[model samples]
Target: MSRESGTATAEATPIHAQVSNLRPRDLLSKEDCLEMFRQVYLARYFDVRLIKEKKRGRLKGTLYSSHNQEAILVGALFGLKPTDWISPIHRDMPAFFLKDLRGDWNRPDRIGMSIEEVCAQVWGRVDSPGRARDNWSHIGSRSKKIIHSTSMLAGTIPVAAGLMYADRLNGGDAVCITFNGEGSTAQGIFHEAINYAAVHKLPVVTVVENNQWAYGTPFELGCATPDVADRAKGFGIPGLIADGQDVFDVYDKVMMAVEHARSGKGPSIVECKTFRAYGHGDHDDDRANKYRPQEEIIAGRARDPIGVCRQTLLDLGYISAAEATTYHAEGKNASEATNEDFPPEVVDYLNAGIEFALQSPLPAAEEGAMWVFKENN
Candidate 1:
């Protein structure tokens, strides 16, 4: 992954010759690669299961499918430390559980939210980390270092910057990673937050999941530059472009940016070129199909993240061809894919979460107004 400077190009060009000498992915052992593959499957399974639940009318709220964008969440979070901070938006619900989930999926002490908690949030039960006070993807845990996000896109960037600033003041060296869609780049808060982080040299890595269409508007109509990372040039920061379909590429690019920030090099913008596999949310499915060309949709989802990761593992000799065909979850939507299409562990994991969510109780009626104001001593 090349470190980009000036206008962000469609292709990455190495800014320093030494960068090509070794990549973050090169150091990964076979076990690590296998874990990454499993994580991808886990993310896909989570999204698929939720879509199924929503359709069954068991789960309320709009379901934002992270269908093809699994790689961005798994890869970006795989290399992050438990102490690191992250802010995931509506499209990134899987990220809540994927963070700090590299080795142990059931570790009680992990910094990431448990699958049960995420499921509880979706079910609007009190078991959610936020106690079901907020709706979908709006919950966060300060202890876990996940920033709470609102509907306002790119609004969390400044929050991330402020969090890291306070951490630095307290002699902490934590880097904050905030996720956003391509359309959020046009928001005034996006520019304002990045400018503040840049001026202060704060360790904030802004990840732009450039899924071709931001809701109904296409990328071309929203931004002038071919690459959203080009906007980073104005702040004099490194903007990197990664193949969002390839998990390894995303990991490499994000790790590079992480290292830069950890070394006190300030902030970076990692533009991951991926496509939204489905409608922005389940509610827009019919409209999305009508507005987006069938050819464009087909082209965007051509390279499924799970398929890409599987091929990488095959090339590295980590998995045999037979193993690759054992579970063919890729290219199949939630309705088309079944539990048998995923690994037993992945299926069981989500099953347990859903079961727990179903059993969890809803918050008391009076709880809604409890957190509205903080009482003074």
Candidate 2:
């Protein structure tokens, strides 16, 4: 519940400060450069659409969107093998770039279908996933080993551990990764998962997307430690702190973690300190300025992960500035198209949710009048 700095903006750490300082080739390659931009841009566009829809009452659910933290998820998955598994939180859905290799996040119809049908198949909920018990970002099938994300805060670590144990039993070389937030560090499950991972040498990498605030309180007031990465030492695992803002740093850190785990080393903790440019939930107040200086946000704006990445592409002559501008304009237009494609009414959605919940019937009601241990005919 605490942060690394006081009200004043925290000084840029060496890990993040030298993003522009790296040699051009060390940061990215022509082959994968544009792909990174596409993923980050798509994530931002998806978030903008979600926020606008929430405001318009077309989408009645809360959004823990990844407006600014796209680089961490995108970069980490850049080199993942098809056999690898990723378990992510709701906000980290930008990894859809990796999840749906053939799907287009910018298509309005597709995105709409995804959101409405993700949880329903019988009703074929318009935005639903068309599958049972595994909708909305359920990228992994039993054979694929990808686990569905739980909305519960800090709850996936042990689940990832169990998957790793499964891998060990089968003598598989695959790995499991879980992405959580800085706020989740306060949860007991976070510590328990890491402790077991370290003690048992599980092949799991815990990535912390640190945005400095736990909903309302700044990190300084939320936790006892300044750097959440420091907590890894207590579990006997290697702690790697990197700049979530720099796609290069994030990639390098992830690659190293992948290699370490593949080499039979224990699980490790990677804390990527980054920002959450949007609000906590769809209707939540940002209150970001109250916790930090306006100047920090403004300064932080200069090197937006998406902007910095595209600029790097231009500087390297991978794409002309005119092309970059066109690409961006195209992305924005696609976002608008997607946003308009799926519009719903608020009352209708509310009633639908209630009916869906009620139709299942309450299991407790059947046992309510029965004794604690009655088994007679």
Candidate 3:
């Protein structure tokens, strides 16, 4: 679908740009500021561990790590309330973890997911919440209202639309948000979903994680528009771009979009301009394909979300160098630890979860076929 650069139909109108230079205090409390850093570190460390597991052959099938794209997911999810629904992409486990933490405000007694549960899911053992029914990254929790993503790119955009549409029909204030890569934005589903959302005034927030490349293909070859958000004008909805590397920017823009939806104003698209540090998945090598330049990767790594956030905290005197190092080691094992920061006990707990999954039995084959409907018992 070639995106036309012009105004939307009569129903569409320009959504005002929120280019606020949000200060840390403006968006986060002292605890929030520190927790944000912890979440970034957790995402980075978890990804690194997954890569190691894949290399060691402990993890089967493909591995999609959101190594450098933590800020986008973390920031976006932070803006959403517990009642709001989310449809996550394959590389969006971090978002699920964050969502669980928020829990249902109405049911404040609900416990969020522990790090151990995430470890089990990544391992895809019998102990995983998916119960070996799905592969890694195709994660969902109905209790948490997260739509498990399918392997097809942009396949779930319409699903998010459906969820939001159903919510609107029920006179509910909930919004549904879906995550997609820049490459997926080129697909027909992306256009159809946005158009439907705009026409029906569905409270759906389509977050385009514009990580410069759609797998091996660069954004330039895949998308004609300079900014994916620019395509929003055609739909007559608000389109905003934010620095995906900067958590505050992502949080600020997404918060505004959430507000717009909750106020019954319709959909908004947010394009987070960021880079994917890994090569598509664990199997592909960007270096071998020469998909991205080594210099560019190095430069992007320099602006690592974890590092930038850590430094921000340090500069603001929110955390000392020693405390930051400790936070970095939270999810990593002792062998993986560096710079004298011993791995935290959570590492042992995660490993235990992995072992539990490994020791558990796979689901019965008959049980899988049983879920299908039958005319008669």
Q: Where does model 3 exceed 4 Å of error?
A: 1-27, 102-117, 286-289, 321-349, 374-377
322-359 per-residue lDDT for model 1 (tens digits): 99999989999999999999999999999999999999
Q: What is the Cα-based TM-score of model 2?
A: 0.71
Per-residue lDDT of model 2, residues 133-206, tens digit only? 33344443444345666667678889888888888899888777788888998899999988988888888988
- TM-score winner: 1
At residue 91, give the lDDT of candidate 3. Answer: 76
Model 3 alpha-carbon miss at residue 23, Å? 7.2
Q: What is the TM-score of each candidate against the true structure?
A: 0.95, 0.71, 0.84
Write the number of the candidate with greater lDDT, choosing between 1 and 3.
Answer: 1
Q: Can you tell me which runs of candidate 2 are displaced by over 4 Å? A: 1-29, 100-144, 286-293, 327-377
User: Which is the better candidate, 1 or 2, if ranked by lDDT?
Assistant: 1
lDDT of each: 0.90, 0.61, 0.71
Listing every candidate in turn, what is its Cα RMSD in Å to the true structure after a full C-alpha superposition?
2.8, 8.7, 5.1
Weakest lDDT window of 10 consecutive positions for candidate 1: 5-14
